[model samples]
Target: MKIAPNSRVLITGGASGLGLALVLQFVERGARVLATDVHEEIPDSLRGLEGVSYLTLNVTQDVDWAKARDWVTETWDGLDYLFNNAGVAAGGRIELSEMDQWQWIVDINLLGVARGCRTFTPLMKEQGSGHIINTASAAGLIHPPRMTEYVAVKAGVVAISESLFHELKPYGVKVSVICPTFFKTNLTESLRGKDEQANKSAAKLIDKAKLSADTIAARVIRGIEKDRHIILTDRDGKVAYAAKRFARPLYYSMMKKASFQMAKKD
Candidate 1:
């Protein structure tokens, strides 16, 4: 699906990070963007941007989605693209992770995307053309040890996006799953872990990664233009994806070594 001029786009978690970058990119490309986040105030950088508007939406809530949908329907008559990008991070050994943390991560990361898809699909179908982009992590394709809850939820997103791609194709709606590696984002602020030391170590590792949200968002726009299904952002993430697909043992070994290093750092 091409992001043409005047395209009506809605993005969740647009207050910061990749979501915000998407908003800016879409707006710059001449699309009408409605950026939503749970935050009461829109980010300062996005405040005065033309062709872009802000709405408060908690993707986890059905009511919030309904409100957002209603606003889009009323304002623009329909949506051309829906970005289900709101998510949180969690890390810990599966056995050691708390049940509440598991629930929180799943609800926001997996179910949040599900809710966005469910809420906006009908509208897109009615319009007869649209794209749905779900942000799954590279961890979804190559499971990293200790980030059990996050990996599980992201894996679920990847699976759902694949399924939806086939299911929605007949209706002229395209679904793309974004599997990106760690980049500088506010995701660390929401990271959950039982061990503070482990959390800090993980944050440090992510901070060292060179990719930025703007680069990822730019890639995402290109992927959308090309109608690509699996959008990967970084070299490491693309390599990990290929390794998992064509060389399973090597992928596992690489992931295991990385996990061991992180454990040692902690």
Candidate 2:
């Protein structure tokens, strides 16, 4: 999984946020980068950049994945890296979240990665060596109050990627799941704003945490080069993950206490 200069890479949701950051980093590293996003326009920073191409894509759709894969095969001949980074954040306790909201979040955050990995793996398998990076979240490891939809989907992503790691190992392909804490991104806007009350408090909580997209992208490149399976972006995320793994009951009890404290304050 060593990304030598001029290696071929494909990334989804690359118009902005961490996807855009990864695109810029790979392009600068001299990798032939193909990026896609639902956004019709390319970012000014990536426009006219050598060794980079942008396309419009909706990761949730099967047709979009097929089209992108075909385009990559035709244009690049093969892919060395595939970053399944498209995701959307939605907040609400499991009992309170709307069904449509859950479906939307899961479709993007979980199913999107699943579809990408399913379709793209065979293509990469042909090349005999490739890497797949799926963007998960710290909340996937340990859930907080609210954000149930996002947390559940991200958790599923981690599970899927972890499973794929073993499945693809025999093929000489690698899989990496990026579990990052709150990063400076527009993911907060993807929350269910139609239900303002449920999302307002969740937004405030997310705002208090600091995780920069630029920093996350740098770690992603390093992890891909090292062929690391799980890439925890924030040091805090690593610690939190360790705590959850060792003491699940204690970890959740502490969260419950914090939820009561926040409710009391409100």
Candidate 3:
């Protein structure tokens, strides 16, 4: 999984956010990237980038994934890395969160990653050398209140990556799950919920976060280079995971306090 020059990489959700960040970094490193997003036309940021091609791919659709798989197999012959970075955010009190909303997020966030893995895993297994990096969130590891949909799907991503890690290990393929906390990104473009206040709170955390997508991408690249299984891209995320692991009482207290604060805002 060394990201060498001319490395063949496919990234989903490449129009914006961490996906775009990874695209830019990988391109700068001289990798050939097929940066796929939902936009029909090329995204402004990727319009004229050399060594990067834009492909319209909605991760939720089976047809789109089939097209991607064919293109990668025919054009590049094989892929070096598959970045399952497409996802959306959803939040609300459990009772207020509708079934449809829950299903929508599950389709895009959890099943989207699942589809990517399913489609490309066999390709990698055949090649015997490839990497899959999934963009799971810190919410996956440490669940807070009011983000059940997001948390559930992200935790699913973590589970998927961990399972694939052992499954693909013997074959020389690598797997890494990125569990990043709030960061500066446009991940909120897809945010939705019945609770406006709770939705805004979720968006605000991302808006006010200090770490830039590039910084997180850099850390992720490093982690992938070392073949790390779980990558916490920020200090807050690392501490939270640690707190939840060995200090359960303290972690529960902190989450409870935060829940009350969110309730006050609501």
Judging by TM-score against the true structure, name the best candidate.
3
lDDT of 3 at 205: 84
Comparing 1 and 2 by TM-score, which wins? 1
Candidate 3 residues 50-84, lDDT tens each? Answer: 99998999999999999999999889999999999
Q: List the residue pairs that clash in candidate 2.
A: none
Ten-residue stretch with the least lDDT total in model 3: 197-206
- What RMSD value applies to candidate 1? 1.4
Provide TM-scores for the models: 0.96, 0.93, 0.97
| Cα-lDDT of candidate 1 | 0.89
lDDT of 2 by residue, 1-266 (tens): 45689888888988788988999899888889988988778877579888889887898899988899889889988888888998887775566777888788888889999999998899878878888999998888888875677788888999999999999998989899998887777777777735466677667756765767888899888887777888987788888888789978878788899788756754
Q: Which of the predicted structures, 1 or 3, would earn the higher lDDT when compared with the native? A: 3
Q: Candidate 3, residue 112: CA error in Å? A: 0.4
**Which has the greatest lDDT?**
3
lDDT accuracy of residue 154 in candidate 1 = 95
- Over 42-70, each residue of candidate 1 has an lDDT whose tens digit, in order, gives 77867999998999998888999999999
TM-score of 1: 0.96
Off by over 4 Å in 2: 193-198, 205-208
User: In model 1, what lDDT does residue 215 have?
Assistant: 91
